[model samples]
Target: MSDQESSTSTSQTEGEVEGELDEEVDTEMEGEGEHDSKHRDSPPLQISSFSSTLRAVIRIKQKYHALKKRRQEAEGDGALTGATGRTSPKIFTFDGTTPIALSVPQKKKRKRRRRVMYPNRGKRRAPPKPARSRAKYCLYLLFAIVFVQVYNAIENLDDHLLRYDLEGLDKTLRREVFGQQGAVEGLLSHLKEYLSTYVHNKPWCCPCTAPAGVGKSHLGRLLAGHFRSVVETLVLQYYVLHHCPQEADALQCARDLSALISEIVERAEEEEKIPLFIFDEAEHMHGEILDVLLQLVSSEQTNEYLNAIYLFLSNLGHSHITKHMLHNSSSTSMAKSGRYSHFVKELTPILRNTLEKLHVLWTEADILPLGLLEKGQVMECFLDEMTREGFYPDHTNIERLAGEIEYYPEVGGHEYSQTGCKQVVAKVNLL
Candidate 1:
């Protein structure tokens, strides 16, 4: 049963046993004294209670021994280490009286039992963490969407650029009727930005010298494609005169120039629009044709009526032309004659003044020593193109290729290393 009920029953049993023992002791003493002849007038009921007590004395002794053994065994296991400190409880009388008041085991007062409130004490004002629920997930999703949009925009822009390049090639072919598209594109890309920016301000000109097979002509074709509709082409290959096989060759060259100019003049007359003239390999212009072309530019019809754009392309270096004998002797006639009549730098005197008046732009390497694609731009282009192909580009590889392209066969010229596209393909495979 429960501890409290068991304790009460045990206490009652012990009291009954002790009371019977006391009575037995008294009866024995009385019996011995009465048998001799003294102390006879004791109550019969007292005698009966005394006799019953004596009979129960043996049972009381046995119960005491049983309880003591049980208590000692319990103590051996450390279970009886209660507050009493006694190995066994003392037996006492019944009738709600103690034979000796064995003091009720004092409950040890544990310093007013200060119950510590450990968990709940510091809980009141702690600021709430994670103020935005599921915010990390939202942030990640937003970033993912932004990244995707940016990637798409870049991809579309690149496609636009490549298509523009191809179109430029076609235009170059249509106008020059000579040269390949790739080299032309390479050349034209350099001047495109400046041309668009200064369309009204400057006459376009890019004078780059290249070996015959290096594709300067092709680059010119690229320009023709680039200018497709924005600027009309009126090309006059003046050098054809120097190598003309017959009189008809000169006549045909004139016809070509006339046809080209006539087409533009007709358009301007019809649409009231100005035209742009492209003179590729302008250095080839000989004495007679040079004078004709100069006359064309100087004419009010070309300058005011047509509102022309003159773009002179050539491979002849400006320094060489100023110092060379060929351009000086027969190409031009100085306005003011002298007795000595020295053949000065005729191309400069002729071109500088004419081009300034018409705002013809000569794409001068002297002006842009650096290519359009700077080192940083090249690196970015490389990484971006490579990454799109699912390859991680190595900076070391790019640097090596850039170094290879820093010098071309020409003394001061640098060729683009697109021929090394194969090498880039191989490196990307390694990644």
Candidate 2:
């Protein structure tokens, strides 16, 4: 039995050992299969020396340089073709499964050229700015045209006064009138302003107020004569003392005066001329005559009356004028300096006020007060009279004739003549 047991044990041990051996073989085979599988899944290990690695690196650099060179050449060709207006084909390369654009080369940095400044660079005119719009130029031209037209219109407004030879009249007044410089200038200035234009809001009404023998009547005669010479038919020299004296019927005189003025104005209007009406010794005009004259000179009159110039030579404010002239005689220096305008300005209101007390007509009149004549002006008057009378004006005789004329301020040296140049013609004739 023991022997049989021994044999079974031995057989079992042997079978077990065989089985273990087979299991070891199977594990070795499985490890070998796994090693094959890992070798297949992973990349193979490479062994290299430094020199071989450097050589491989050089070859890779060479390949990369070759690709960059090809890309640059392709880009240059594309640029050249693009400049010629030709379409360029894209160059692409495949690395395994991915494609790369090799025609698009890395941009090279451009070399900048040094700037060269020429001496005349700043002096060169910049391109001309675009021309101003034609509408702007047209606007400027229109403005200039409007300005010229307005200027011409303003100048033409004074043509009427110039046409009447006002400069010549001014020269005559200055040359003929003596010691009445203020009066003459005031009268001329007003006339020039009034006659500068044909259209007026009212007629030109001037009152010459002065004492007797102060050239009031002479001034009126000079004006009347000038107007008669220029416009003989249009000039009316009406003498209140002669034409319609105090004894005449006032109403009848008024009627005749109105009819005469109407006829003269109508005729002058037809001729396109301004009429002149000189009322001599207006202080003697009857109330009825004054009323008619007032109506003619009133601003309420018809348009025809506005085209006429009316002058009233009177002694209405003679007392006030004489007193003012005497008081201002010492200040003749202002008159000598050609600044006697203020004297007339100062005396105008006085004369107007004095005359207005008699009639409101004077309120509308431009007052021209005749100041006292200087001794020198009286001498000039004498010389002028002598010359007009066809006699040689000797200065000695002129001085002698001027000496006979009474002067104001009897105590002091004679400065102003008492009677101005009114009596100069008579005195010269006596001489």
Candidate 3:
């Protein structure tokens, strides 16, 4: 009976140990279930975990693409191929089940190609040029400037005064100065003597008095042409002292005359050329201007070079000269005895007196009287003019032209035309 009772106690102790182990297992299973239920009930915790895992996957993909791109660029090929001839490994997510293809960034194409080789590459260029070369360039530029200036000076030196044809003077005289042969020859002789004095450096002044259309200006121009090399003609009527409407007042005219005289004096001094100042229509000039002219011509200092000639042309003493001729030539015998010369001598003092009364600066010695032209001389002039103009007129035409010309007793009766030789050419044109 003792042995049976020990065996029964051992069996009871084994049963009790098994029951405690079962209870511990049941409690652990309940705690695991509660943890799983809390995880399911809170969605924020699950989302946070999933987001963190997704971010980790994205980061891993970026790293893989960067590495692949670098390798491909180094190998000069696509991301799938490597420099070592091996394919690039594919990337995966954390689960290793989902494959991830990280796209490698492409390189932009270059607009311009870079040169791989150059002829003078890796070598320094030549040193700066020498100063001697720069100086030579400067000298060339200076020489060009000097050459241009010398060329301009040569051009200026070629300048000359404008003058009329001298060869036509004889033709003009034969055609125009018909019956005034004695008067013209006498005047020309006086001019020759005057020019001789001028050549000896003696200044001269002359006043030529004549009726209108008696060829005073024409004669003056002929004389000017004769001595063109020494004479510079200034026609007052055409120049600053003209009778145009735009002429300045008397005072201004005097000023202009002064300026012109000063310029002429300076030019004469510099160029050694004589100035023949011809005052045409002297009657139109104011007495003040005439006085200024007289002062200019009379001044010894102004005419120091004897390079001036003042020739005053006017009709101022025409009537007096005509009357003197008429009174002295009352008879044909008296007229043929060179009575005009005597009359001129007689008229000098009278002209001086008249000029003095008029406050004129000129004296009787300056008077060079031009008389009326003859009818025969007028006919000769008309015929000469017709020949010069290429016209062959018949005797009837010549007679008609002669009849058209009017004669005035005041101008030496039939010896001179009323308009002198001025209208002779025009009347011939009408025929």
Candidate 4:
């Protein structure tokens, strides 16, 4: 019971302490509430002083900017006055204070634009061409073919029978014959006439007859040399008596002659050139061969492009010609006549008869007898031969040789050249 009483006293003391602590706390709370209320009741502290200060700062900044602008303007004016020697305007601030200078902003420079380059930009490609026409292609092909054929023909020209060894003929003429000016001139005139006849579209023939070694072949050569430019080919075919094989009969001879004539005619047509065919030692040709040659020349096929000269050199009927010359020497009437013209007139009939007998189709006008070499001509020929043989004989030796050469009237008659100037060189050599 004492313990319970003690417990109650302690509890009562504890409550009183608690109540006192509560009261103190209430007072503290009231004081704090009053303070807070006073603080809340009063108007919020105004920031007007700070706001006024900011305003002053802003005004100062504006003034500073104006001063700086004015100072810059004054400096610029001073610089202008110093440079130009002129009076500068005064720059002053509105507030009348010393101006402050500020840095001026610099303008930026612009960059230059560069040209851009691309690979192959400047190159231009050509447009594709149109197709060629068939006609043009065909024409080109034809031309190519023709050109090839012509080139081949020209390359093979040496293989043709019409082609001859001109160098050999030239050598022979230079070595074997000399000094027959009259004969050469007469032959040239005949050739010119033949060319004129062809130009006039007339068929012509030249039949030259003379004794052996009387410059008949030589005259033909001269004619060839003169007309080389005019004639495409100058063919000389020699018919050597007893030299040709026995098997070369009349038919073989005709065929050979025909082939040669055909070649010449073909060449003439193809080359567009006149041809001259010389038959040397023509008297050795068979009668049948002559007939074939005549037929070939006169044929319509040949005559179309056969603007050619057929020169036949022969020894036939030379005796008759010489006899006539001898007769002219004896008879005053014949002597009064022109020798060549009269001889031509007289010899034509004999040539006609002889050729007709031989079955040749030739006319009297075709025959032209070659002139015989005179004594003077023989002497000149001897001198020429001596010179050719590397001998330089004086005038006395020349006169001696000339006197030593014998002349015979019976051989060709009328002091005709019996040896036909061929014996002169041999006789001079003997001397």
Top TM-score model: 2
Tens digit per residue, CA lDDT, model 4, 261-365:
777777766665567776777767766776676675663644544576677788777777666666555322221225556556767787678766765556533
Q: TM-score for all predictions?
A: 0.30, 0.67, 0.52, 0.51
Q: How accurate is candidate 4 locally (lDDT)?
A: 0.60
* TM-score of model 1 (CA atoms): 0.30
lDDT of the candidates, in the order given: 0.45, 0.74, 0.60, 0.60
- Model 2 steric clash pairs: none
* Tens digit per residue, CA lDDT, model 1, 1-431: 23664466556655665676567667765775565355356434456666765676676577667765765564455434543323245565465553445558888776776786555665765657867769899999999999999998777656534534545554644344221223333345544433232213323333444323233444445545455544344332333425443554665665567666667756654643345455555556544554455445543443333344455555444334323322233322221223012322234454344334433333121221111222333354456557778765788876765454332232223222222222334544455
Q: What is the lDDT of candidate 3?
A: 0.60
lDDT of 2 by residue, 314-396 (tens): 87877886777666555334334264677776877877777889987888777877666678877877777788899997898
**Which 10 residues in a row give candidate 4 its minimum summed lDDT?**
83-92
Question: Which scores better on TM-score, 2 or 4?
Answer: 2
Task: Please state every model's RMSD to the true fold in angstroms.
Answer: 26.4, 20.0, 29.0, 26.5
Error of 2 at 81 (Å): 53
By the TM-score metric, which is better: model 1 or model 3?
3
For model 2, how big is the CA root-mean-square deviation?
20.0
